[model samples]
Target: LYAGVGSLSNIGDQGMEAEEGRAAIWRLDLETEQAGIFASGLRNAVGMAWEPSTGTLWTVVNERDGLGDETPPDYLTSVREGGFYGWPYCYWGQTVDDRVPQDPALVARAITPDYALGGHTASLGLCWMPAGTLPGFPDGMVIGQHGSWNRSTLSGYRVIFVPFAGGKPSGPPRDILSGFLSDDEKTAYGRPVGVAIGADGKSLLVADDVGDIIWRVTAA
Candidate 1:
């Protein structure tokens, strides 16, 4: 299960409602209406998947607030239960923004995310390629950073791959699908929101919300 803060609020901002912005990972026991918190403090995790090899759950998180067009960078993270990724308090480990009040006590209590995906990427869908499938893909997670609209220059709107080693994320992301925008790099044709490995074992599926189309990518 993946959990993250669903809203924008600093660690101890009294004005912020927990229910409004907080996200939590929960497992539902269908036998009972019982669910438990697996993790917390995620701004918005729109995509999640479990790796078949290590049984680890990974998520792509949309960080809180635009932060005046350049403050906080949206992220793709490997979520761990009982982990508190600093949402409104701190971002990308230690850069503190004053717009959101920081509680030194709570800030010290938060766990930093696994990877920093740069600012305003609007990361959305996440998927992991199973082993022995695509020759070059290996077994890593691919995330669709949905690009940015709340920025002056704009960012994201492309598909990227995050390689994994030893059953964990090893490094930063590499662009896999680009050129969605025109030559000016201003207008966009498709806004990728989801990514999944095709059932054929050799194709990649991507959903573009703006274009209202689903694209299939195959090994060349």
Candidate 2:
């Protein structure tokens, strides 16, 4: 099994000393009673799912904030074993972050993610959808972006569908649920946190944290 571990502070604000063994995914070997870091440098690897076609593990990551609104974008990507994604030193593959001291060695090796989920979307939940389960969805993935609190204009707060072709993101994301933010963008009606395929195989289940509700979407 795989489990995610997030960093203690943003961009090692408390110092690199505080970031030891953090921002990584760990694999547990129950038969052998062993556990170790499977991947590293992911700030918040919240949601994880395995693709049915290729069995590749994918995750939606929440990138760092406080670097203005659009400096770095959150992303969804297939996880690479023993891969290092930039955290404090760089973002989006070699885009240096001035806030943290430069690390040329680590920055050079940071692996770029497959797809961007927009900056500061606070993307969290992820689940794979097989073809024919939902009309027009095809074989792809569904993600719940909980939205951002720091930006002037809110992002996310809805569910999005990303179509996949050949086991990779093939096109732009399609909005499944929206309007969580108020008309004036002052308050939130609901925040989407997680998504899953319902038992009926035709409905998509959503977890809304702010409204304290669970929503089900089905083709009419």
Candidate 3:
């Protein structure tokens, strides 16, 4: 099984003391009774799924907050074993974050993610659709962005669809459902957390945490 761990105190801002054993994906082998980190430097990889066509493990990560509204974008990408994704020291492959002290060697080693899900979107849900379901969507991913709080203007608060080609994201994101935030933006009618394809195989099931609702969207 693969489990993702989040860092404490926003990428070691309070100091690396709180970062021990954090910001990584751990793998456990039941047969051997062994456990180890599968990957590192991911701040908050909240959602994960396996792409059926490629059998690749993909993850949707919520990047660090407080970095303004658009500095760093949350991402969806194939998780490489033993890969290092930028968390505190850098973002989006070699973009140096001067807020914290960084090791140049580690920054150079950081790998860029495949697709950007917009900065401060708080993206947390991921689901892959197989062929014959959502014909317009083809074989792709549907993500739920639960919205943002730190930004001056809100972001996310909706579901997005990413088309897949050759086992990777191939086009711009399309909206699935939205309008979770109130008009004034002071209240949230709903917050999407998790998403999955329905058992019927042609509809999408969305888990809304705040409103206590599960939305069902079928292909038209």
TM-score against truth, every candidate: 0.86, 0.97, 0.95
Tens digits of per-residue lDDT for model 2, 75-114? 9989999988998788888888898988899999999999
The full ranking of all candidates by TM-score, starting with the best, is: 2, 3, 1
Go through the candidates in order and give each one's C-alpha lDDT. 0.73, 0.91, 0.88
Give the better candidate number (1 or 3) by lDDT. Answer: 3
Candidate 3's residue-wise lDDT over 112-217, tens digit each? Answer: 9999998889899998877677666767888999999888899999999888989999899998899899889999999898999999988899999998999999
Badly placed stretches (over 4 Å) of model 3 are none
The digit string of per-residue lDDT tens for model 1 on 6-26 reads 553434356556455356555
Arranged by lDDT, best first: 2, 3, 1
lDDT value, residue 7 of candidate 3:
89
Worst 10 residues of 3 by lDDT: 130-139
Give me candidate 2's TM-score against the actual structure. Answer: 0.97
Against the true structure, candidate 3 has what lDDT?
0.88
